[model samples]
Target: MPDTAGLAVRTLTPDAPAEAPPVLLVHGFGSDGAGDWIDTGVAAALTAAGRTVIIPDLRGHGASPAPESAAEATAPALAADLLAAADAAGAATFDIAGYSLGARVAWAVAAAAPDRVERSVLGGLSPVEPFTAVDIEALHRAVREGAQCPDPFTAAIAGMVSAHGDRAPGLALCVEGLRDTPFAGGAWDAKVLPVFVVGENDELTRGIDGLAGSLGARLVTVPGAHHEVLGGPHFRDTVLDVLAR
Candidate 1:
């Protein structure tokens, strides 16, 4: 099939424009469009500040389609979704930002199609967290066996992610993507001067810093846990600084 990147895209169009262009937000793995940022109030915050915003549920995460194979879910494929979504959102060109897994996809998109994007804020990822070969055989076994655990977070520390997915047909697309993309953790083809944000004390922070240093980018520490950083004032201030630059 054609490059799977950018094939899946969703938008949250705004009614007003701020001094700057609209901001597209991409959520991390295991979350959807609304709960990802809309429910978190990030979308509303920027909108209130007069910045038009667009949020997408990156592949294997939300409304976007999950490719049947990891090859289809590669960073290139998911970046394609940003393009399609931006076009659909009526943003001929735009600034973009993403969190965690979403941040990775954003990097992929910016790397693959820099001309289409102006600036980007990548939150919660570091280059040190290199993507490794997956134990797909074991992962598939867990899925087929209907596994459940109260302390899955412990395992997630090693990227052993698990979630109760939707029965809706759309979820299958995302799930398939999760199964396919082993997150071969490294910067792909990208040269954008991205604004990277991470939580202080986050194990992932150093990794993100490493990535930024390699790319001639800068880093911002938001002083919170990984998931909650997006909600705090630091989140907005950091983003505004990036956009202002």
Candidate 2:
């Protein structure tokens, strides 16, 4: 275990090489790598395929220390931390996969250093940025008013964030940090091997195909909604297929 710019990271190496590049798994907002990857069986599957797995608890989540300043919580900054995790894992170049918010950071990583990414799977992502219009102040008010907020999802997340105790404010700053972090069609141009996976019923489906085409990446549609997509067999199979290629 080591720190990547204040982020906590864990690496799981396979007993044998399946000829696959080491893989990095980045989790979504409010969630950590273990909760998103390991608990979902993604990490185990990758290891079963003989690929080493690098899982980092992004700053402000899990065991990682939260960023006291919004500047330290930007997506690009998080992307840089991923590279640090790669260095810790002794991987100069590696395969990568990320879900939701992590996918945004992954795009930044590949955009900044395409040569270091052998292949990348962007899951639960779309061309439209999700946090751009999120009303952080309203969400904060809802949290303070209790869990009986108007948006159930927001309330649930507020609960999770607040459960971390004093880390809530930092998490709020993180939300603000990512608010303007663009994943718009032209914001990132990654030439690395990239793919997109989304739930067929996901609202995030808009512009995903176009974004994938722009990157010359394949788009895989799996059954289920946004959060449920990662648990589907289609997602698992698609990830393995892409990595195998």
After superposing candidate 1, which stretches have Cα over 4 Å from the reference?
1-10, 13-15, 129-133, 147-162, 166-192
lDDT of 1 by residue, 1-245 (tens): 23324444444545666667678888876667677677777777667677778776666655455556555566667777777777666776678888887887787777667776787888887564333333444444445454432344322422334454442223333434544554444554434578889899677656566566766778887788887787778887777767653
Q: What is the model-wide C-alpha lDDT for candidate 2?
A: 0.80
Clash count list over all predictions: 16, 0
RMSD of 2: 2.8
In model 2, residue pairs whose N, Cα or C atoms come closer than 3 Å (at least 3 residues apart or on different chains), thus clashing, are none
Per-candidate TM-score against the hidden true structure: 0.78, 0.87
